[model samples]
Target: MAKQFENNMEECFSTSKGVFYLKSLSLEDNGSVSQVIKKRIEAINDENQESEEGDAFFVADIGVIKRQHKKWKTVLPRIEPFYAVKSNPEPLVLKTLANLGTGFDCASKDEIQRILDLSVDPSRIVFAQTTKQISFLRHAQKHKVKLMTFDNEDELYKIKHKYPGAELLLRIQTDKIKGSVNFGMKFGASLDSTKPLLQLAKALGLNIIGVSYHAGCLIAEPRAYRDALEHARSVFDEAKELGYDMNLVDVGGGFPATMEAGITFEVIASRLSQAVDDMFPKDVRVIAEPGRFYSTNAFTLCTQIISRRVVSTEGDSDPTFMYYINDGIFGSFRTLDFGYIHPVLKVLRKNQEIQDDWSGEKVYTSSIWGPTCSPDDFVAKETKLPKLESGDWIIWEKMGSYTSPASSEFNGIPKPKVYFTET
Candidate 1:
């Protein structure tokens, strides 16, 4: 099935009806929205015509990844992005980032080894996880992957004994944003505890080179970036007083892939650029660990509606329709737990033929589910969608990041195979 999807991409194959040039379609082309969707549906049907793989797959646009990198450079030109490997660790995504010269933010020994296998420089990888397994530390040392992070005093002792020569960044706790992923809870040292930790690192003769902090993932406000930068500056000042030549300050990952209305990347970048200029020196190299910002908008998910149910509702409201899709929360949607992500869904018109079910008062209140037997397998709840039937397909956008890498082949439902494209 994976091979067939790959072949379809290479052959630029489409159904006998016509070619659907979705690769060339832009988001701004609202006029071609239906045409693009029709093309995607055709592409999926053409590839999975005889497959028992349940007709669910992901389409990755390498162009979208490239465009995001360009946008990052255009916005915050100073800060280099270390693509978080945990986001979507698809081999293609990693290869695309490596080709773009983006660094990686790895968490486990496995992630580090994988990036290193790509012939990526050890310096281009940061073991961002503050918690260290001694064996993993030794593995990093053995591979010469030196840069890592530490927060608590116990981690200092572990690193002191396991990999004393490793260059370190003190991951400090930042202001917790309401409704954002509170990374500080698990990682980050308190501002008050940073000095003691740095003193301990000094006492142990360990190499503490700089500081890092995660504002929060899916930051709701741009002010979080500015505030986190300001907090990082204070840590830098303290590091200077402690006689450490802090050359870097990781303004950790909190960037969004696609911005909400009125809160644009331009606003965030402008704030970040100004903060970096004000807080740090010209020679000090600044970098970021941006996960979703680089990967989220790069892939599209195509799922077939396997089954559905209609249940009663109160008043004149349309009945609640349940849609069973091949993929679920356990699959590519594990990241949905972090924030309120409402995937923009479109019902694909097959062979450029509009379905009668999708037209005329078909806006039904619906919920989409995954194939797993677990009741927790809900994908989207309370979605207003056109009435759909079994085998009808839907496209979920902004699904590239935190989707595949986190998926599991649980309940005997295989992971969604991906089709990579330059378009």
Candidate 2:
């Protein structure tokens, strides 16, 4: 399972499959891409993989995966990544996730078709559609993907008419999170509606084995999860009342991934673990769809400065500069407009430390604009960097998950490469 890579100006780039730009490196004189990466790793003395757990890439950090993934924990924590393929469906990413032994949570036929091309097993995928295309239902059935979701009767009927022998789960509608930006607006059928959805499934002889919900992304309160438990309890209670048995409870993907602030994993995990002990049904199998949590910090995107624009003000004003980069919204940092910050660090320039208070200081401001021809190419609307020149590399760490999976070459820009690490 070795991969081929590409080099731009001698720096090494590692995409999941072939060469990528984000993992780009700056090469020494007369160096090739592969050599550049090896040299960089050797210099850092962090390139060696000791144990599977300590390595950056490995299958699930769970045991068997280590052997299969070799030192990559054979794919890097095959946590059933249920990869939000819509985020960035580059074959490299899918193959990487698949190699890790993860199942997918596909939403559309095109997405399913794409994964199918790569030979992903139908059983390793869950067609999680709240709204599904009727034709795709038969494809899902024909393909042997046994699991799916719904919050309404229409979805139930569509699946019933197309593939009635399917297994199903009712999408539990989570309440509005106080300050949620993305997930609060869409999805869900209330506690009452869930009853009928479940009943509808029973009526059609659809195997209703589970119940699911999304607390929405970046939920602030541990209580939000705690509160959702109550909703789930009510749903589970209804199933029992209707003489139905549910074997699974899917706490769908709302495990927050860096919306600047939210409950930490240690805290949330502790709380949920306690709740499961006290409340979760004795016979239920617990499954979580965590698209962001595991992969959020797994990788980073490195973009070089293609150009720098300096903005200067008058009347004792400080000099502000913008470093337009080769990657932008197309690279999936568009959430910045909604205050999503991925924590930027300068990769090549080691001496400059990001300042805590540069308000009064002469701050050199710059914007890392993506390579799109559109005026909206800026990824970070206002970026503060040291006096940097063109070609200096900027590292946006923990960007592996949503970044590439959601990127687009709007201006025909070639997607950047992805490099994995066991360091």
Candidate 3:
């Protein structure tokens, strides 16, 4: 696997400083991911004895991403994946996807430039933003990144004036499903309005080559894809009536990233593929923008406990504890503010035997706080945890999506550093 990765990805890893390398480890040789995390913590502790630099860090498994790509190909061979760049713009992650020959869904000029920096062809990138900035439009035109999405007539005019030759995807709104992020509220043209938009584009002599829709983020309803594809087929029919030969379908990202998601990727892929096969001909190119699907499971975060405070409540037999970690909502845990649930916490005691299950140990009602001055800088509330001390570690798995990229250096706390490895 390492040799194959080296052969396919080494050229993309070259930079001005040096070539980036991924530490390859087999489970039989190096044990499990927990052991790797424990070893990393030990090395950091040994090196930072005087500095006391117990800052949070991440261990990203590139092999997981490679496996995800392989799985995508095996399950949804008809549809191509254009990874959502905004999910986690870690350079190595981008390079790895690019090496695997996956296209990109870029929302900004910088994202386009990042993909281009890896020597990716402009055609492999789709400017998936609905309302693009004029400057960003100019940049995309300059770089020959032609494919873009638009939902409104004003955007059609903007694209016509700025990039008349650009191929376009008319983004239609999906059903207003409950319990999911409503991307339709902010973007996507209504099915009623898609025809008018297509007509306007045809009148402007602008190219309309596809239809796009997002069924919202972390959506569990597989029928959302079915309904959205039906809506898209209607738009495609409208375009055909307007003499536009639409050939692409951009099934916008919202695929679940974790097993905890109410719906599995396999089920969603099966439904989507069946819908595509039923609704459209095989000649049409099918693609999806999957941000969390490719990223969420590939990275794990480990934060060191910076301080611990025991709080006693009257009439309570056990004292409630509040432990503070180096990283917080202002840093890598910012996704909590956006309605993401708290990550399951795993305790790693200093100089203690490593065990996956801690059910036998004594547990206490605890609350975890971030190392921030804000009152709302809480990581976990009223959670059960073992007795832990300062300098001990807390592990969070499946933290790759919308964590690092959205992190801020609020209250002077820096983002966690990422270390790359492969299994």
Candidate 4:
């Protein structure tokens, strides 16, 4: 599986550094995943030494992305993945997924254009956003992107008049399923509105193709998908009664990138697979808009601590330490607005042996802040970590989704640079 990904890495370049390297670094050369990560980080640090301005960067493992695709193929073989372009649409990430024969779930005109620029077939793209600008709709139509999602009557009219040939999918509400960021509140239609929406589509002579629902983002419970699938089955029946061919069932993304305790991907996949098998027949095409699952685990964020503040506390408790990193909420930690917390941090010491025993090490209750001016530009609110100082480096895993795409240049903090490797 690793070899399959290695052969496709034609060009490996880091845009920020303006440097080029061969794509021949395979897993075998490094011995293990940890070794590969350490070697890559060392190389990145070597490059960073020449620049005066400290910049956070991402290490993207194409091998991890390929392994994820392979895992999906093994677990839920029937459901094809439409990689959500909104989540960490890094060029190399998209190119890798495209090369692996995965489809894309685009939301905006720019996203559609990005996928098209990759030379991906229009048939492999789904305009997955529920609300869209009129110009973006025309762009999709001009580009021949037929599959799109809608819920309300206004969207139906827009699609009917502008992109009449579009294959519409009714996005039903699935908020009952709790997640880190639930789309049911912002997107999906209520259960009561599903039938009328389908009727309205039929009245407008719109091509209603199927049903879709997003259980939530970073979902932990398998029962959530089971519940959403049941509603999808009901909507499929409604579409059929309205003389619409409801063949595609888009069980939208909520798959876990990193499972919480007592939860596993296999558990969710098994429950979802059983639900689909019991509800839909073999002819029905099942697809998912998985963004984080394929992304989060594939990238590691390397950030440098630029400054720190120590606040003395009362009496016996330890003082609170605040460490400021080069990147912040405005940069790769953009998803902090959605209540996503940074993972447990790993301290990478320069020219020092990796510490195995931290039992006697001085630990502090610390808060990591981004380099933004805003008081709320925090990455981790409260976590215990070994005392860190400026110039020291910290690493976070599972950072590829809902991070870079949502990043901004607010306060002049640029988005992190990304480097790709097949190993």
- Give the Cα lDDT of each candidate: 0.77, 0.60, 0.83, 0.80
**Residue range 110-217, candidate 3, lDDT tens digits:** 999889888899999999999999999999999999999999999999998999999999998875754347777788898788878888888999999999888886
- Number of the candidate with higher TM-score, 2 or 3: 3
Best by lDDT: 3
lDDT of 3 at 138: 99
lDDT of 4 by residue, 43-81 (tens): 646755545335787767778888999999999999999
Q: How does candidate 4 fare on TM-score?
A: 0.89
* Higher-ranked by TM-score: 1 or 2: 1
Candidate 1 least-lDDT 10 residues:
10-19
Q: What's the number of clashes in each of the models?
A: 0, 33, 0, 0
Clashes of 3: 0
* Candidate 1: tens digits of C-alpha lDDT, residues 300-409: 78788989899986785668889999888888776687663446666653443543245565587889999999899998888778767878887788887778777887
TM-scores, all candidates, are 0.87, 0.75, 0.92, 0.89
Clashes of 2: 33
Which is the better candidate, 1 or 3, if ranked by lDDT? 3
Model 2, 1-423: lDDT tens digits are: 123223333333344344433222222312432233333333333455333211111111112122323422222222223656654465545555665666677888877877776677887777787888877887887788778888888888887788887777788877655535445357778766777777777888777777777776666777777777678777878888887887767776755443435566556656665676567755666666656654555555556666777767787466776776666786556555554335455344433432334456444666667777778777766766557676555656556456655666677665565443322
Best of the two (2, 4) by lDDT: 4
Which model, 2 or 3, shows the larger lDDT? 3
Model 3: lDDT of residue 53: 47
Residue pairs with clashing backbones, model 4? none
For candidate 1, the lDDT comes to 0.77
